[model samples]
Target: MIKDIIANTTNIKLTVIIRRALQGVASNNNPYLTLILQDNTGIINARLWDVSATDIEALVAGQVVTISANSLLYNNELQLKINDYQVLSGKEAEKHYQNLVISAPINVEKEWKDLLKTVEDFDDAILKKVVLHLLKQNEKDFTTRPAAVRMHHNVRSGLLWHTATMLKTAKEIVKVYHDREINQDLLYAGVIMHDFGKIWELSSQLITNFTLQGNMQGHIVLGSEQIGLACRTLKINEQEPIILLLQHLVLASHGKYEFGSPVLPKVLEAEILHQLDNLDAKITIIDDALKPLNSGMATNRLLALEGRIFYKHEGEKKKK
Candidate 1:
């Protein structure tokens, strides 16, 4: 049985397939493969011990190979010292290596249906029509697109999943700011189409890689272009289309220049979209990082979701 390196202790033999091999230096002189081994539950880092030229030649990234290693904690993080390793060549590799990734735990179809219900709750016809068109245009891709290349919700059906969450939050905010003339239509449009560019930005597999277009134009540019084209095809009113398109711009840009936005959010709706998106992304990072920790104990450290460290919620511990 495959065991997670995270829970493995000394002398515990684990049968895990090496998933990724990252090169790094050890002890300032030795080269090592900082590997990531995965099973069904989770992935953890492992250190390939006693690296030699011959050993390095036998393994390659993405190959399913058996590893014998001893687990140890370094700086409060779990890691394994690989003792012996070999690539499972041919059929064995094919049987163990899974390239396609679609999370089965989450009920994507049910979640999408519920999301549509939330969209239907909106009384505005124009906003609904715009959303319907965008969704229809990219329905196939959206259903299977990962939200990002490696960050939050990077799984099949992730684009829809993230969009649905953002929409639900935006709905609550709309009710609060209804009288402010915040343009609910634009707000909803922004929420639905904000990250649609991600469909092209990332590879749609268990291991996502950046595409040429993704590297050349990035999501913000690609997403904006897509919205522009959809707007023209629908022949939406010029002013309304501009506002709707700006909604996606706000989401794509997030806030500052460093965060990959060409321009910062200037409008009230745009500012709100940035804040909501930031909040959701940060929370997701913290939540996913802390999943391996025991219920009551605090985690050692978080690698900062958006360049900032996060402390676990104290309230969750009390309740537990």
Candidate 2:
């Protein structure tokens, strides 16, 4: 398995899925291929030196392949130095493909049911209808797609896990702010709709990648467009206060223009939704980075977290 391959390993032969493949030019102007490979356990980068055009054509993304390589530490990260590789065929490829796709470590059906219930519990009719409509329409993809290509919650059913955790967190936050002027239903709807476009933005395949729409429009713009369509189908008035506010939540979920948000959060609900979204993503990244480390050890710099290193406290108790 990918997790068991470390710096000391040699003469490694494994069946793995090609997550990504990119062609590059070496210093001497020779063509090479850089591949991101994955199994059910984890992902790693591999370099194939002095590659020909025929080799590049054969190494397609999302295909299963058998490879010979050696593990080595490069810049404090483990990478593979590939000597040779071949795309698998027949029963061997099929068998490896079935086992190589990683998924969320939770019961997807249960989490999906919980998500439906959360939407159903919304007291505002408009909010409830909007959220439920989108979920039901995209349920299959929403329940199975990854939240990202290489960031936090990038595994299968990861979108659901990310949504479920955010919903739970939002519910608690609403209770604390209940005494204030906070609109609980708007918050609920906002939380549910924030990443709704990801269903179309990301592929649900074992090796996830961006769709054409994802690269062109992005999740924030795409999600806002989805909300608008749902509103129109439901006969939601364009002039209604909720319409613009809900769209704002989706548009501003990323919190800033530099972060891909078209606009910064103006309303209180949008601000809260953005904060909660960021908080959950950051926590998940840290948790994932610390998983393989012993207590008191610091994880390698996480690229997603702007190259930040996190430490696992020795005295901190872990959940079962």
Per-residue lDDT tens digits for candidate 1, residues 217-308, read 88777777776676678887636855455644544457878878887886777777788888877777777666655555555555554355
TM-score of each: 0.82, 0.91
Best by lDDT, which number?
Answer: 2
Q: In terms of TM-score, how similar is model 1 to the real structure?
A: 0.82
Give per-model CA RMSD: 3.5, 2.2
The candidate that wins on TM-score is 2
User: Candidate 2 at 234: error in angstroms?
Assistant: 2.3
The residue-by-residue lDDT of candidate 2 on 85-198, one tens digit each, is: 888877878878868988888899998898889879877887788889989998988988889898888998888889888989988988887787788888878888898889
Q: Could you tell me the lDDT of residue 28 within candidate 1?
A: 68
